[model samples]
Target: MGSVTTTEQDLRARAEEVLSTLAGEDARLREDQWTAIEALVAQHRRALVVQRTGWGKSAVYFVATALLREQGAGPTVIVSPLLALMRNQIDAAIRAGIVAVTVNSANNDEWDAVYADIENGDVDVLLVSPERLNNPDFRDRVLPKLAASAGMLVVDEAHCVSDWGHDFRPDYRRLRTLIVELPSGIPVLATTATANDRVVTDVSEQLDLGTGEQTLVLRGSLDRESLRLAVVPLPTPARRLAWLASKLDEMPGAGIVYTLTVQAAEDVAEFLTERGFAVRSYSGKTAPDERLDAEADLLGNRVKALVATSALGMGFDKPDLGFVVHLGAPASPVAYYQQIGRAGRALERAEVVLLPGREDRDIWAYFASLAFPPEPLVRQTLGVLSDQPLSTASIETRVDLSRTRLEMLLKVLDADGAAKRVKGGWIATGVDWHYDAERHRRVAEARRTEQQAMLDYIATDECRLVFLRRQLDDPDPTPCGRCDTCTGTVWSDDVSADGEAAADERLSRPGVEVPPRKMWPSGMAELGVDVSGKIAAGELAGVGRAIGRLSDIGWGTRLRELLGSEDRPADDVPVPSDVLDAVVRVLAGWGWERRPVGVIGIGSRTRPHQLEHLARRIAEIGRLPLLGTLPPVGEKPGARENSAQRLAAVWGGLDTAALPDLSGVDGPVLLVDDVLDTGWTMTVAARAVRRAGAPEVLPLTLAVDG
Candidate 1:
């Protein structure tokens, strides 16, 4: 907003009016909130507010928006992350007579209307996601106009702007470009509750308007007096789940049960619901409508809790949220602090329980692997993208990266000026680009340090809040005297017998559906495979079955011991009897359209004995004939490789000639394997079996990657 000719008293009065409207008639502005408002509105200064979650960070912006618009400046532009956050912010804006509209991925149908409202000056605040800022159409058509005329800019969850932050997003790096292009004296306010000293400096640098003016940073303490932290270093996932099942009722109020992955969220929600608890799962995979319902349910206290991943972390506002229970520790203490901040916002007492499990480290490493790829991989990706535009699918054919990682790398390259995103796809800019190897290396090392700090948090015997707050560089962090360590743990270490029994039973249960791959990976022809489009209907593999996922709590725990990766690889021994029994149960429970007449093993270089043993046992138990082994005839890629690479490796890698005459078998054949990663091996192998004259194929696997 342009500098307003206003006195401090006048500005404070106006800000108080807005605050009262948003909160209540008796509501007053905190001194720090008033200071931020004055800096933005009266002096047109850029600012950063790093206060606690409920400390009126939003009030500063809302009040400034009212004053600026009242003084005839353009509407405020807010770059928020979550749809739930936007919804809540819009509602809060409306309370102060501010017309706010959001243009996110979920509301494409209403974008035109929203845009018209903005143009007509009928909207006071425009909320968008950071990704929307770089959309080809939006960036080309709308951003220039908005930057030319916006009053103020707000970056919610500002820590994400720094690559060193726990949730660094590449799209946020574009804020620098957006800021540089803004007109002089246009105020920018970046706010977050989770940033430490390093993130604060990084965000402050990004917030610099380059108008010979400095960013006014106001960082406050990161402690939450209302939160009582507790940590339970459970020995097993089953015990942790069991403890949750037992202690949930004793928890303070309606809250959240946090998980590290989508499958865990769904699994925990299902287990709790089966135990007659009112809970639903929320994750990045949940449908928007379902997320809305779940959010509404929790807001209304219609459910006891929502089992959610980090997707439900930032910007979710529920002042009276009673507690937050993390099933596993996050990779960093800073991130854990942010997630637990959701609780005790408006209450005097709320429980913050952490049930740290051994599997958390594995999950952390999986995410770590997705960090900025090595320079060689980056050079390869750049080599693939020439002057001609290639959609991400086309790029996948040439570069060996997963879809998620590929998208992230493309964004980084796009920001690095080595690639440009266009409507059709991405085009190489031919810039003399150099990968920031040093920076990324430091970031990676920082991640390891943060992960170890998290482990240390679990093992610490000192003040819990002090340990967490100190990670955020809080000034003089001291004991809160409210945590379990300071005030002895409230809950017992032992899980009730009944709760443990139910959880063990649930974890031990078998049979996860393994749907067949219908359409082949795009650009397979370019990869030298002729197969494309849907699998030939006559040759399609039927829906398959797996005893469990590698990430599952029950059979997964056991199966991992046998088929686990480098950490726990098993010797090529005979299949365990219990596992065989689980397979028997899975097969008996699977109501296939046609029962298999024979079983065939897909040979594994790593576990040939185990695969053959399981296949032979299944054939013997089912009273079916043992057909043959589909031996590997070519070099195969790692099981964790992307779909395109995996497919190319296994296209003709199987020796169909190894099989005996299958002409006599007319019914379904059980295509068995030790583990399924990308599912390409199974697809190619099953296609060969069907072509070998088997009428139908029922694929079975010991474990599937979650």
Candidate 2:
């Protein structure tokens, strides 16, 4: 029944009635669902329900809401994680004749009316994102009143509250204040589909509400009877693409094809469309309206699948989704389980397959780099904070940290009470904060253990389902008899010649626009440099092109070997002929506003031989003059972590005078580099050339290391 439950006989009958309306005419609460609901309604106790997807967890809350409303309970407050889940919860509540309202980032205009309804008891439930709990205005002006008056509290996707959870979020910790402030005798429910014993224990303790009373935790078996798991080993990205281009249409119904990167999702979707399969690309980069349209098409079976990143995972309510295919493995099995759980929720049988690659570890490592920054960086962030609040961007201008990493650090500090987010920005609370190095070290160790566990899952010969469930610490990890190992089934590795050719062609294709930087980094004046606003158009580097991103599945594979991480500094080598051919093709199709008349190479201290060789070949192939290199004045620019610092290092470090005679050149000069990391090096070089009288500047690179 609903989260707001009651023990009265009439209310019990009403809970069933609401369940029927919400689920179906013959629907009733499952035994475990009833057990959790009764503890909340009858005993005013907290409950944690760890059931698999489609276990009718929503039904418990909806039924309880109806029963408790009959006895004059206030509206329930649900802290949900995603917009999709909130929409689904609202629709589900409507089915049970409950008026549910949501207060989230998307519906700012409706907040006044939503709050008014909550005050009038017109809303049966209110759904919100965890981030909303700490919103300056909402936290200080709205939360305390809402918590005091709330009939019940629900934390959906509750695993996020724990640092050990696979997809931990800092804002979810805000639930602690709400839970503690919630009036006594208000039933509370915390729910999730993916959580190990550690995550469960963490979440259970968090939901205990400091009442010295144990929370009732109902954890069911994670086994999904409808899922048939398998692994299709493709040796290369091309082969993986070929398999999908050929095998996707043959799957039972519409589903999701998961990719580790946004570009991969778009690339896969593009190829699938070219193959005449109805599909769409979904990722964090996709526009909000487009995501909605894509979700609608999938729900209506208008598309075969939405090639997506993890952005499309968690709380997407597609009950009949037929399959989930992974282009690369996640860092941990728990995360993989969360993504695939989106499928087979309602079907009697659904396919789950993994097409993992060796490059998966590289991607995993990139993410690992963002994990809690070193103590020095943490202190640097805190040192910048004071009684006067400063926006994150303002602080970024002074620190040598990327925006993403900076935000993560700030959130962690906010949780530790060393800093607090306010209306203006963030300010230091002056709290004596200990680094808690031991706790952070243990968390890091746990993450490494999880990554190793994912590798183990891929190599395991046991039942795939059993292996996955075991990773989540499932109590009953029996063989499912449906996985490839259990059934002695093997997927053929071969692809049709046409499919293979298409894949090879697509992967081989190269070139992506390398848009030039515009505005100067904020707070440059603070660094004893004087620059602000946009870069003058004459000095700006033209929208250039790169052979491909270092993250792409195709050129990315080759580029990694040539330009990625190096164990030790060594000698330079010549450019591969095939890569040179791709660069020629890229230039041929560039269609620049003005053709480049000469080429200038960016000097590299370590890779000068390789850099000069590529530039000379490009100029020769195009029959253009080979201008001298734009020499480096100091040490070469590496991957500078901070925006302001990266710019400062390259500000006056390029020796434009090394380019023998830019005065004689009249056309846009092609400034070639081996790799483009921050794009500041290119920008600084272009500015120097443009000042030296080149009409315009166009940057060309072998790879973009964004």
Candidate 3:
């Protein structure tokens, strides 16, 4: 509840006892580590000691334990989010000669033994995972049994509780609640290797500690000046591997090559192994023991390098890493910083190489696409998991997906701690229950867009360091005079195939009139044209179908063409080239006359000027349908739902009517449809429209299912 009653002499004596217990004469705490511990003991306050990786975060915990024990307090309970981390710290504690026992799921006997020892004042330190601590049974059955227990709650990797932190674990959210249930004023010490400003705030809020309450200690940015960061762009797959090989040759250190996929990791590792580079691969599928062995080999220099996915470095503390190579683009800067931070931990020179290009971008985009499951698929999955445990059959029956893809999706959910496998089926965890599918999808989309931006960044021939620094939100990025782009060593921006920078010249030349919304103000000026007659009604219906069809087709170039009509000459009005071309193509395919110009209207007879104008107007109407229709007679733009607007609405809900063969009407016209829930309705409409009077119809929609 408060600072240890142990005096400075008592602490020093206990420190000596801990060293003697560990049987190491020179294994003493560094000045910074000792000062941090003393500050914690003196004030009995919460503190944020941001020691860098390999800076002995674990050792500080032991120092606190010794001080607390010397004051005859109960055994200190250290809460961590990860069981692996708890075990790692316990191992380190044993090595440091601290008597510690872990109460985690992996070993029940050890857990009970530790609880009994703590209750009887037999153990000095008690380590438990946050998940174990949250278990109500543990608090009711095990925790209350501890004797004289008023020890501090030392939280490791506190960033996990912060929403803004990259790896947010929802279980951590209940930590504050759990702490409140514990002894009041139990000094809370939170530690992390990395904590940005937002993360720090999160820790403070969740722990109920104010800034003044938190003994703040910040080590300067651990940016290894010796670690050279380079982004290499390879347009194609073959070139990407070649670039990777070249970079690997340049470093040839005990490094790790991280990739976006397990297959990529395996392939890269195999390739390196074949090329006689000592390489071992690690991924989620790699057995835990095997992964640990591989990591140990890499850190111990037994394996020259490790080819891994992002799964390897959760709490890895390797300082001798000479390089951290990203085989593809990571999702965000936070990810990149964490991976790269693994290198140069010893303040030794290292390198962070990124072989990023179009192929890597494509792979990242593909993964991101998986992040956003279709709404129907998500709804179906949720429904299936409603009554029973979720299995492959349930998902397959509910969501139409291949076995391979479904398995990947399930794994992704599992990795994000959304659902956990139980009794051969997936059950939603607390984290999964709170899963906002749409929000996650939006995040995925945003990441994909950002990945594209990163690709653009890599492809650009600009000051690479400046670009990287700016992305990290660095305020004063004086160009690091070292990168290939900064020096004349390499070019940054690539020139177009034609040599000069891509042209931004006059795209629209004179002569052609850009299609206006109303080509025939006089021809069809009336808001409500007489639709009682078969020909007029049929024409209106056909135009409506064509308008609907346009929504489905890709409009990138068309949008540009519309916007491109800016500085064109008067008569040179760009003839809505894009929309006209679309209409002509549709008509030709539908076997229509596909007239060259004059009014392309559907009527028995019309004046030549009117015909030409109708053709133009049809194209214009395709762009913006309400142009020819008038608003309600008394309505203004602000308060108008005119006949034209109402007609457009009706068109969206129209049933295609049979038309009599009209003499003047000709071939295929572009038809726009919004979304294809099922292709049948549009198919039937196309047929009926063609049979009536229109020669042909090409129907398109915005999106369609396979």
Candidate 4:
């Protein structure tokens, strides 16, 4: 016992040496940090650390790695969720005198060298994104060896493993298999800053090695004394934009402005830029090079803000970030807390504001719609997979889900062993799988509850910090003295009249170009359609115009009300005069190379009269001839199907006999429709019109569903 105690002291001394190297000469480990390292290195035990953002969670792992490596252990394996996090960790590890290497989708070419380094025992740590864990080559050829020899395994952002987590990821669930394969007695650590009590319990259970060993759980306070939290409720989208444009200059230092959707991010960035603010937009759609540039700009304080969607969340480390302003509320208080945590990390004070919008719930619902599909859909996807692997594209041809939704479902299926992803693609494993309907329903209910809690946070007069902490089940739920509610200080809700006018003008500016589809969806031949490959350039419809996207922050709200329900009787509604005026504005601003000489109407099964009225009015305004409307075929196509299936449904769905004699037409024809959804409808209809001898077809619509 005396020798054991002396050895622990020696280990502690060695740990302090490494911590000082990582954090400077004066650096010292806190008692909890030392305890965690000791648990992992000395006792060879598993641990779960739930601490605040800047509480040195990474330090614990780095120090543990140093100690374990000194004792001749294999390299640590960190299953990170984001590329940014992995990059930061690798740099930090190198600074701590440890050689850290990573293998992620972004660095595929370097993976071979990284594997060789790990095999040679030159690597002290190996960081991999969770998705890489399931890669066929990595999993089959390398993972078994890595698992057998891994000295320590670390799961960063570990809350993602639980479905109850606000940011649940299916790929993280695959860690369970990796955990089961790890050699017994190997130390494992999972760390997260956003988990509630439920999430902590779930993650702790997942960390168990199944050898009658319990995980050591360490949870710290979720408070941030430097964050001055507040809620700024704005009634309208225009008012919110105006507030941001006029008031952003008053906020301290460079930071981020969060939006709920990609469209919102782009719109906000454009508005701010027009108002002379130095800002850039970041989203999943942003190019990789552009994203890196944007990150650098923000880090260098070259830009006022980065208008971003949730793609900017997690793993972004900016220590002195001065502010975080939410243009819209996240769906849950937990997510909101995580975002705001990005601010005030290395500052004495930082501004954190939430400008809750009325449209936030709508956005939340749209995201919630992408959750795990129903049992029937899951069964259908599994049924389609066989011993012979099929690529995601091929599976998509058979399934109705969008690519994102389909990939998410497949990941979940693969994690559950109902399906397997191979080099070729994904295949069925012939394992019996049961859908956890009750659990999924409960998860859906939990999401709705979280949304309501966010609304409550926005509306409540209670201390915002206390409310958020309570939501996270923090041990000490005390009112933070820095919040607006606690101090009875509210930010000005004023927007300059000029700013409001500028925002209004920007929002009211109608018309977005709707580029025509230039290529046929693959597997069209499998759908029994004769067409395949590139669409003939001359045969395609020319670039057209729409009032706006139905998902846009501008005209979308009004268009949603105008379109109403698809099941609404077509005769019950009349075209709104405002919509007609907007359509006129679209044409007036259309810089077409050649003016259309006539108008053609596409028959709308749901709103034939509206389309006819719209077509006739356009011809009257332009002093052009009005062609007869095309008739609908056997049945209206269902909206929720693959592109190929949709194209097949509409192949002969239009009656060309009703088209007016196009030989007499002198120029291009304007084809009017209520909305443009898959573009297949317009594609098929335009082909029919051109086949009937129209010189060219230009599609026009009230809105486009992006």
**Per-prediction CA RMSD (Å):** 2.2, 2.4, 16.0, 2.1
Instruction: Give one digit per residue, the lDDT tens place, for model 1 in 536-593.
Output: 9778888999998887756666777787686667899989899999999999999987
In model 2, pairs of residues that clash are 1-60, 1-63, 1-64, 2-61, 2-63, 2-64, 2-65
Arranged by lDDT, best first: 1, 4, 2, 3
> Residue 304's C-alpha lDDT in candidate 1?
96
Task: Using TM-score, give the best candidate's number.
Answer: 1
Candidate 4 has its poorest 10 consecutive residues by lDDT at: 564-573
**Predicted candidate 2, C-alpha RMSD:** 2.4
Give candidate 4's whole-model lDDT.
0.88
Model 2 alpha-carbon drift over 4 Å, by segment: 1-9, 566-571, 636-639, 660-664
TM, every model = 0.97, 0.96, 0.55, 0.96
Model 2, range 1-706, lDDT digits (tens) per residue? Answer: 6464354565567667788889899987788987777777767789999989889898888787777777788888888998888888999999999999999888999999999888888999999898888789988887888888888888899999998998888888778767877787888999999999999998988888578898898998998999988888889999999998878877889999999988889888898898899999999999988988999999999999999999998779999999999999999999999998998888999999899987898888878877877888788889989899898878977777888888777776776678889998999999988887887899899989988988888888998888888888885767999899999987777898888889999888988999999999877888766888899988899989999988898888788788646453535888989999999999999998789999989988787788889999999999998877887787665556777878887887878767675777878999899888888889889888888888889999999985
Q: CA lDDT of each candidate?
A: 0.88, 0.86, 0.54, 0.88
The list of candidate 3 runs beyond 4 A from truth reads: 1-35, 81-84, 103-105, 133-140, 143-150, 209-219, 246-249, 359-706
True-vs-predicted CA distance for residue 573, candidate 4, Å: 2.9
lDDT for 651 (candidate 1): 83
